[model samples]
Target chain A: MIVEVRGLKKVYGSKTGVTAVDGIDLNVADGAIYGLLGPNGAGKTTTISICTTRVLPTAGQVRIAGVDVVAEAPHARQYIGVVPQYNTLDRACTISENIFFHCLFFGFSRPAAKARTAELLEQFHLTERAEAYPAQLSGGLAQRVQIARAISHRPRVLFLDEPSAGLDPQSRIAMWDAVKGLRHQGITVVMTTHYMEEADELCDRVAIIDHGKILVEDTPAALKQSVGAQKVYELHLRDQPGRPELCARLSRIEGVSKAEQTGDGVRVLAHGADGLLSDVVSAASPFGLKDMTITEASLETVFIQLTGRDLRE
Target chain B: MYARAFAGLFLRDLYVLRRELFPFAIRVCMNPLLFLFVFTYVLPHMSGGAAMNPTAKMAGSGGGFGTVLLPGLMAVAIMFSGIAAVALPLAQEFGITREIDDRVMCPLPVWAVAAEKIVFSAMQSVIAACIVFPLAYYIPSVPVQAHVNSWPFLIVVLLLASLVAGALGLTIGTAVKPQQIGLIFGVVVVPITFLGCVYYPWAALKPIPWLQFGVLVNPIVYMSEGLRAGLTPSAHMPDWLILAMLCFFLVFLGWRGIKGFYRRVLG
Candidate 1:
């Protein structure tokens, strides 16, 4: 494993009594893009903070590249790069200076630091902005510079906390590509994000956490399957008297797992094959259903099923 | 191990400081210029017939008063530089921006990190003193006669004073948060400047017995006292006493400041 966290426990205060992360176990293999998917306040930041040695863990063992973090945190940090959710670069310095400082912190000599900074800036497409201070950069540009700084030293593992949280669609895609490129260099990437699609598209394995506990952990495909084979179908039709009762009755029929009227439409939750399509079509024939569409079991659905709350909330 | 960490921190701070070098120089120049004009020229010319004592008058008369103010002004300059270069920036770095996270992550023990900050800040303090030195030579009645008698003493005193300020800056930097830093200036720094013997000798504050006792706690007073003793032959304080007090304050503040720094950074 490139990273290992076992029985990590962090309790805020005795009287207050909040366990941010309670006995959590994690194992991430090398070169894997592992996502710790969760909503806000799900201990994602705390977990990453502990791994980065930003906050001392109340109790646990964390190892990066087989080196004990607690025993030798500074050396352990050499193998791990952390891209915090917040911008931690010096706002007073230029983009190139920021990268240069980061390299110096890791013991790089001046010329070597300058050379490597140039390479990373070019790679991140931030070479033109080398002389610009962080305050002069756009949100997406600042985040890219942050990534370039984090990776300038070329650590073995990277911890990114909501790396693209507030980014626009195009910037988010660019961030994802940058992350994917890290994997090609055999760098293990661990990230936390609320964007379900981001987790679905990038993560090889995701650990879904809620209320400081891992609700589920598996590949995105396995997680959706574990939730159920049932794909939800929604039928937008004119509301009629006794519509909910009729939908409930239809749900009790063979081939349909559950059905309920939500808003002006009847939503049918079904399993098995598309053969059930005929049964649903016949069942809704009398209701004059229109604009029918099928939706798969999204990570959001699995999260809601497991935790009973929207990821945003 | 410490050497490696020290070099890294020194070089890193130096590199960033170069970008702000112009502003930093301007800031260092501005404060001392204000003090020099107000005290040596404005205050003296405004007040009749030497409310300033003869030692001060003579020191002020032959274009030598500026020399007397030089060391004290340099002390103040060094103090401000320590606070500006290390304490204020460190408060911010540890606070919202939290860029110190990167330094704390360096492959060294936490104490070494804190030491690097003090060492780097001390280096800046020395640079500030050097810049202020030439400006101080222009102030009237600084006892140019004393300069040759005391150049070596002056150099040593300035170095010791800078170290004391650097250590104290570490304490302040770790003790306060970024938002409260302005309050530190209002409450802590203002008193240190006025009572810190920047304008008068420690013995001069003695006649107002209560005031002297009150200002005794200000470490800047000892630094200025040491500088005055070194730069002025007829300075009120004894040379040995000034040296002794400087030694004491350097050790006392250094021990406490370094301890707090380690705990804050390490924890």
Candidate 2:
């Protein structure tokens, strides 16, 4: 394994403490793109922080490329690079200087640092903005600079924390391409994200975590299969929800695995609703709703089923 | 391996400062210039000839008390600029943005990160001190005579003082959080500025025993006295002991700073 985390535990305080990560075991193969999919505040950041030597773990050991993280953090850090959830670039420095700083930190000479910075900037399509400060760049450009900085050191393992959190569609796609290129170069990658499409498109395997525990871990295809990739019905209601008790009653009806009230309507995940459309309407008749539409199963449903709640919640 | 890593980080910081030299020079020199205007020119006219009474023995030509105080004030300015230039930025990088994370990943040990910061800050201190030399010559009223004999002592003391000030900065930077950085200036910097003998000598504070005792513990007191001893012939403190004490404080504070920095960054 390129990365191994066994019995990892981190408790915040002695009294009234909370376990950010509860004895979780994780493995990432060499050159694999592994996704740590979780909702907000689900211990994903804590896990990445420990792996990257940013935060200490209360218990457990992390080995990167066979080097112990706690025992030899600097040496282990040599084999790994991390992109934090927040952009940590020096906004006062230009784009090229930002990347060069990372290279220099890894003990690269000036000439070597310059060459490596140029290569990464070109790859990230940020060559033109080399002279611009981070504050002068767009949100997408700043994210790319962060990515470029992380890879400038050319570590064997890369950890990305929500690399596409606030990006638009075009920028998100561009980021995906850059990450895929890393895997092609035989670099092992570990990332955490809530974008289901992002995880589905990029990751070879994913582990879903909730409330400091892993709910399930599997390949994206297997996870979709486990959740019974069936059609989902989304109802657009006429008025706001009046009763939760009535909604729960409708959810328990035949052919429906779950029913929950959304902002303006109810979402029903049906198991066998090929011709059961009218039945769903009759079930929801008491709620005085209308404008229903059906769609295919997605990773959103898979996430909801594994955790027994929506990813956003 | 450690030497190469340290050099790399050192050069990188220096390079960034070089590119922004114009604005950096203006910002650093501005503080000392304002002090010169208020103390050398405005305060003398405000106090009229009251300043002449205190320094009548050394009052020669137009220069009097203002001339005597110029070198001491320049030394204090050097110390302040050193801490402000590197320490504030270092603290911010470590706390908020975590830009230090990249540097910590170097093959060198974690303590080298703090050492590299001190080295750069000391260099900046040297530049700040040199700039003060020319300005002190121009500030009339305090017409400081350029005794060529004081060059060696001035250079050595300035280097040691920068080390002490930069190390003190590192400790303060690591001890506080990002939000409380402003509080550091208000609580620590302000007190050091007033009690450090910047405006007067330790001998002048002899009249107030309680204030004298309090100022005795301030490192800036030693720094200011040492600078005055080098620049001014009739300075109050024993020059040799002042130099030795400044060296001791630099080594002690630097050792403590490196220990604390590693514990915080690597732990």
Candidate 3:
């Protein structure tokens, strides 16, 4: 494992302390992309903070490349790069200077630092804004520069905290591509985000965390499979008087595992799609079913099924 | 390896300082220049003495007030520049934005960050003292002849004074919060300047023995008196006492400042 966390716990405040993380164990393989998926204040950031040595764990053993993080933080720091949730680029210096200085902090020679800075800027498509101060860059560009700085020293493990939190779709795609490129370079990546689609697209393995604990950890495909369904059937009902009554009746049908009223229709999850579709239609016939469509189960559906709450909430 | 990291951090600060060198020079010179113009030039000339002997009537047993005020102004320059060097940057670094994570997460140990701030502030303090010295020596209305009797002693005193100022800056920078920065100036900096014996010699405060004893606790007092002993030997504090107190403050403040820095960064 490139990263290992065992029995991790964190508590804030003294008199009425809040447990931010509670006994979470995680193992990330070398060169794998790991995602931590959770809602706001769900201990995702706290887990990454402890792993990166930014926050001391209350009770845990975290090892990066087999080195204990707490006991040998300075040594462990050399192998890890962290792109924080906030913009931590040095505003006083230009983008290139920011990256160059970070390289120097890792004891790179001046010529070597300059070369690495150039390579990172080029890779991130930030070479054009190399001389620009942080204040002059747009949010997307600033985030790129921050990532560039973090990786300037070429750390073995890169930890990104919400790397695409406030980005447009295009910028978020570009960020994902950049992260994928890092995985190709044999760098292990650990990231946290509330975007379920992002985790599905980028992560090889993901852990859904909430209330300071990991609710589930598996591949996105396996997680979706664990929802006990291969496909979801949506039944759009006409605004009839008995629509709610129809929904309750459809939920109790044989082979139909769960059924709930969505904004525009009733969504039904079932293990076998062989007879479930006809079953849903027959149950909804008297209520004046308008349309019915079947689609593959997704990570979003799996997350909602596991947590019993919307991922955004 | 640690040395290289330290140099990188220090040089980064130096680059920023270099970019703002002009404005920094103006800030360092403004107060000392104003104080010198009024206390050594305007007041003495308006009191009716001739150009060379303008302040003879106001002269005490040692010399005119200009002689006494010169070293104090230099001390003020060093203290202000030193404190500003660390305090302003630290306030921004530890503020709500907390833009210091890059440096904090560097491979170097945490204490090196605090040490770098002190070293950089001390360097700026030395520079400020040098700038204030000539202004104090030549700007007075009356001829102020500061006899430098011992160059070695003068060098030692100035070096110790700079370290003391740097140590104090570290303490103030780490202790004060961003919103309460203005309060530091009002409650800490202003009072330290006024009670630091900046306008008079330490011995001249003998008549007010209570105030004299009280002001001794101020680190700036020792700095001012040390400069007095170097620049105007006739009116100064005891050499041993000045050196001893500054040395004690250097150790005490450096220890406390590093501890505070660790708490703020780690927490």
Candidate 4:
């Protein structure tokens, strides 16, 4: 395991305190991309902070490459690189200088730092803006520079907190591509994101977290497969809901796997909706169906199934 | 390895300062330049000349006001440089950008990061002292002979006073809010400089007994008086007491500053 977290917990205050992180245990394999998928304020940032040795845990420990983070944080820092949720690039220095100085801080020789900085700038497609100050760059460009600088020292583990948080679609894809390229260098990556697609697209394994605890952990495929459906049809009725017979009648359809009553609706989960949408619509029409929506069973659906709420909430 | 990290941070600071050398020169020289130009040169050259000036009478010598101000202005330079180099920038970093995060990620202990700030600020303080020394010496109308009694003693005071200035800057930088940084000039800088034995010698404060004792707690008192003992023919506090107080302020402020820095950066 490149990153080992054991029974980790962080409580903000005393006995009746708010627990930011509750008993999280994870073992990430070398060279694997691990994602902590959660909503806002779900302890994802605190977990990464603990593993990166920025925050000391109230209980338990994190070991990065066999070194306990708490006992020797300085040593642990040698193996970990971090791109926090916000840009931390030195405002005083240019892009090239930021990366060069970072390498120098990690004991790189001047020439070595120069070479590494140049290589990172080229790798991240930031050579054109090498002399630009952080404030001069757009949000996407600045984020790219931050990523390049974070890994300039060649840390084995990189923690990116919300790497795609304010980026445009194009920049987010570029960021994902840059992260994927790191896997070729045998670097273990641990990232936190609320975007389900980002986690599904980038992670080798994804852990769904809520209210300071991991509710489930699996490959995106397995998680989706566990949902046992490909299409989700939500039927909203103007009339009374919680009608068990409506759900029972809908589940009897050919492609429908299961049906459950919601507040003013009945959700039908189906493996394939082909030739089954008409049957579902007709069955739900008797309850005075006001609206109907369809979506594929994705990580979002998996999260919704586990937590019974929208991830965005 | 720790040395490498420290050197890296130092060289980075040096590089940044190198680019801002002009502004740095202006920042360190402005206060003493105006003070010397107005008080020592303009005021003395006006109507009644030296006779009518109460400050000249207070010093009790015809060409002594400039002589007294030489070391006193140098002390001000050092203190202001410390605040400018360390405190002001630190407030911006801690509050606005959180740029200090990258430096803290270095494979060095957290305290070393704070130490690096003080060390870098101390160098600027030393440079500011050097800059102000020459200006204070030559700006007076009477060409007051700013003689150095002991070069070795002068150098020692310069280094100690610089370190104490940096420590003081660190303490202020970490203790205050970034939005409230302007308050430092009114609350910290003005009060300390006025009560810091800059305009007059500590010996002259003997008539105001309570104030003389009260100003003892201010670190700039020792800085101004120490430079007085080292650089001029003016009366100064004893050598042992000056050295002891400088060291005391350095340790006390350094401790408080480092603790504040640690808390601000870490969880």
Q: Give the number of the best model, judged by DockQ.
A: 4
Clashing pairs in 4: none
Provide the DockQ value for model 4. 0.82
Tell me, by TM-score, which candidate is best. Answer: 4
- Candidate order by lDDT, decreasing, is 4, 3, 1, 2
lDDT of 3 by residue, A247-296 (tens): 68877887777787776667788877467677778888777789988877
Clashing pairs for model 3 are none
lDDT scores for all predictions? Answer: 0.79, 0.79, 0.85, 0.90
lDDT of 2 by residue, A132-245 (tens): 988787778888888888888889999999999988989899889989999877889999998788888999999988777878889988887776637677776665655465
Chain B alone vs. reference chain B, TM-score for every model: 0.87, 0.90, 0.93, 0.96
DockQ values, each candidate = 0.47, 0.48, 0.69, 0.82
| TM-score evaluated only on chain B, model 2 | 0.90
Which docking band does candidate 1 fall into? acceptable
What is the model-wide C-alpha lDDT for candidate 1? 0.79
Candidate 1, residues B46-157: lDDT per residue as tens digits? 7652335433543433534564566678789889988887789888887778777767767777767877777777888889888987777665433343444677777777
Residue A116, candidate 3: Cα error in Å is 1.1
Pick by lDDT: 1 or 3, better one: 3
lDDT string, candidate 4, B1-267, tens digits: 899998999999999999999999998889999999998888777855562334444443445588778878999998998899889999999999999999999999999999999889989998998899889888887655456778888888888899889889889999999999999999999999999999888988888899999999999999999998887767779988999999999999999999999888877
DockQ, model 2, C-alpha based: 0.48
Candidate 2 stretches greater than 4 Å from native: A14-16, A233-295, B41-63, B91-98, B142-155, B177-180, B183-186, B239-244, B251-267
How does residue A149 of candidate 3 score in lDDT? 84
Model 4: runs farther than 4 Å from truth?
A14-16, A240-245, B51-62
Compose the digit string of candidate 2's lDDT tens values, residues B1-267.
567778878877888789889887887678778777776767767877345435423423554565556666666766776568656887788777777776776766677778888888888877877787677668746455544357788778888888888888877777777678888888998889778877776677767899977887778888777776776654457778778878887887788888777766653
* Candidate 1 wrong stretches, greater than 4 Å: A13-15, A233-251, A257-268, A272-294, B1-5, B43-68, B141-145, B148-156, B236-267
Cα RMSD for predicted model 1: 3.7
